[model samples]
Target: MTKLMKAVVVPAVKAAWEVRQRPVPEPGPGEVLVRVHACGICGTDLWMAHGVLSFREFPLLMGHEGVGEVVALGAGVTERKIGDRVGLPMMQKRCGACGFCREEHPDSFVTAGNCAGPTLTGVNVDGALAEYAVAGVGGTVLLPNGISYEDAAPTVCAGYTTWAGIRRADARPGARVAVVGLGGIGHFAIQFARAAGYHVIAVTRPGKHELARELGAADVVTDGAVLKEIGGADVVLHTSSSHAAAIDAMTGLRPWGKLVLMGLSEDEMILPALSLTTHSHQIIGSAHNGLEYLAEALDIVARGQVRPMIELFPLERADEAYRKVADGEVRFKAVITL
Candidate 1:
């Protein structure tokens, strides 16, 4: 008989989450079976739950920011071994024959929107909101030691995306880096920017100023125009799910500065051509970017340079956790612990 494990599943679109028993999946070729210790609930998971994302497969098992130890390895898998701690990010597998994958440009797979490959974890296929999950070897990252499963779980997606945004900014030393939306991703942006030697400025709504400062933000402001009055930002990392917020944050970017957008908004964002060209500003869209970036993000967290603030929920209370995440009640990130 196949082993059974408890998993959080959605039977239909916008349905309430149910913790049900699912057969533990076996690892296929070039894959590893991870006994999941923790998984973070991301905005993408919430979007998928509501059928906001393009993929609409039913009975969704939604979780991408997962971390655990490799319990078994499939045939031809040598890079990962049993007992190795690892993280499963959003992009599980890409078509190796595609131009993006052929060139090892994982970033393009997301930005160019041309990936002809397996669907994303938690988006189309069953994900890690369970006792076990399988991940392609190429898409998994070995988690560094010294970081708990809870802390490392959020780094798989939230930390990785924010770190990629910071890298996309490529700001000079001591530059003013402003982070928009002090949520899960934005909080990591502030810490990573500070670690990268940039002066961090957090742009967020009221009541979050103190939290921003606590996360290494040198300054905190309620509006983007306030940043302009404070000499402008050399780089702005936009992590809000609101395109309007991104537009407002762009106002704070100095001439020749770059604005890195790592958020997803349902509505379209309008950019003024004249203002964009006149300012000589560049807009970069970043996602998980690469496994290398994920490794770096985990390493940073492991080294104590960055810390993840997460609320933990047991497997039985997964529904409550999902509700809190959907309701925006999680202070930073919510991680389900097995």
Candidate 2:
């Protein structure tokens, strides 16, 4: 018998979504069917729905972050059993025969980005907006102790993004780091930097000063105005769509320092190349992270070092959630429960 489950579907661009019934997916070869608990709304979801990003097909089941339990495993899958708690992340799934997959170094992420989310899966493939989802066993993370679905959801994206930027910075112990745009990624950045022994200076508009401090920022400032006061930082991580801010991140870095840009929004990014060249600092843009760094980041969360702040809503309230996110009213991240 075919099982029909509720799914949040985006039927078209610039149109309201419909909650329709989708047949529960069967686990294919090397795949597992999971009963999804929570899936967070990401910035990419917002952009794709509103025509800000136009690379995806419509009528999409758009979500990447999911925490759930395994219900069934497909052929050739014997490692994990039914009812195992795990997290399904949005990552690249490269074919093992590809050059990228074969070159999985410690510095590189997992070899599974080819079929990943954002640009690929969720946007391209059916994602976790439904009550049940199917994910590959290769890129999934089995959860550690005491990690809840709501909490673990954000780590799949926001946490990994922060980890990528921080690691790319190669921040030394006791060094000062600045996190620009204190939203989902920014909140995690402050916590990760503080826990990693860096003095975190969180930069946002004035409206977020108190919230920034509450998230463990050593200092908070209005974007670019008060931000310049803390000159010559060891590293600056940009999680904003602002093109000018991308340039500022580079100039803010100390000589030989690092500027990491994690947010690649639709806005055209224009940077002053001469200034970047003169500083001798490097500006690097990182896309998504892999399992090894994600596992280490999860360890940090398990040890109570880093946490994500989120606003929750049920699956039925997705439109309202979208409004709040589109208006920038969401404090950190927003998630729709199934």
Candidate 3:
């Protein structure tokens, strides 16, 4: 008998989300079957649902940041075993023959943003918005023992992205680091930078001041000009989706400072040529740099050095959770508990 499991399914672009029964997917070669315990809803998932990012097909199962347990293994799989805890990331598979993959450093594939052939879970393929999902063995990361499924879900993407941005900045100890945007990613950036022994400053709207402080930000500013008024930052992590905000935040960079961009903006970012050239400023774009970074993010959370603020919803209330996330009503990240 084919086993059936509950799944959140989008019938078409801009269609109403449905919680329907789907057959438990079997792991293929080099794949493992995961019984999803928690899945984090991301802005990218919203984009795909709203057709902002046109997927090749509809009726999609969308969720990239998912943590669960391995229940079954497919042929030729030795690295993972049943009952092992794991998390599935967005970058599920990469073409090893591509130039980006051939780079000397694994992080280069992320910096280049072009992996010739890539299989993005929850984007181009079926994802973990279901009771059970399948993932390639190479794409799954072992979840540390201390962190819960809900907390570890966001770490795979949100936490990983911001941590990668911080690593890309490569700030010195005691250096001032300003994080622009107080959303899911920005919030994580503040904690990660603070844990790394940097002076963390948060740049966000007036509403998030208290939360920012609670998250270990030394100072919270409304914008880049305010950030500049105080001592400028040696590294600026841009995690907002507004290109204008990124351009504004550049003014807060100290001489020879690094500005790392982790946000996805539809608008083209325009920088002042004179300012950039004269200051010798370096602008970097970062994403999930490597699986090692994901592991590190999880480790920090497991050690209690960082915590991800999240709102939880049962799988049955998946639609309500989606609505809250789309309307920006959730305080921070939203996780669907199974």
Give the residue spans of candidate 2 off by over 4 A: 54-56, 97-120, 223-228, 249-251
Q: Which lDDT tens digits does candidate 3 get at residues 21-54?
A: 9989999999999999999999999899988987
Model 2 whole-model lDDT (C-alpha atoms) = 0.76
Per-model RMSD to reference: 1.8, 2.8, 1.8
Q: Rank the candidates by lDDT, best first.
A: 3, 1, 2
Pairs that clash in candidate 3: none
What ranges in model 3 sit over 4 Å off? 97-113
* Higher-lDDT candidate of 1 and 3: 3
The global C-alpha lDDT for each of the candidates, from Candidate 1 onward, is 0.85, 0.76, 0.89
* Greater-TM-score candidate between 1 and 3: 3
Residue 88 accuracy (lDDT) in model 2: 71
Candidate 1 lDDT score relative to the true structure: 0.85
User: For residues 1-338, could you state the per-residue lDDT of candidate 1 as single tens digits?
Assistant: 25999999988877888999989999899999999999999988887788777575688888889889999999999999999999988787766777666776644237236666755666667789999998888767888889999999999989998897787677788999998998888889889999999999999997999999999999898887898988889888888878888788778889998888887778799985776899998988778666777888889999999998899999899889989988889989999999
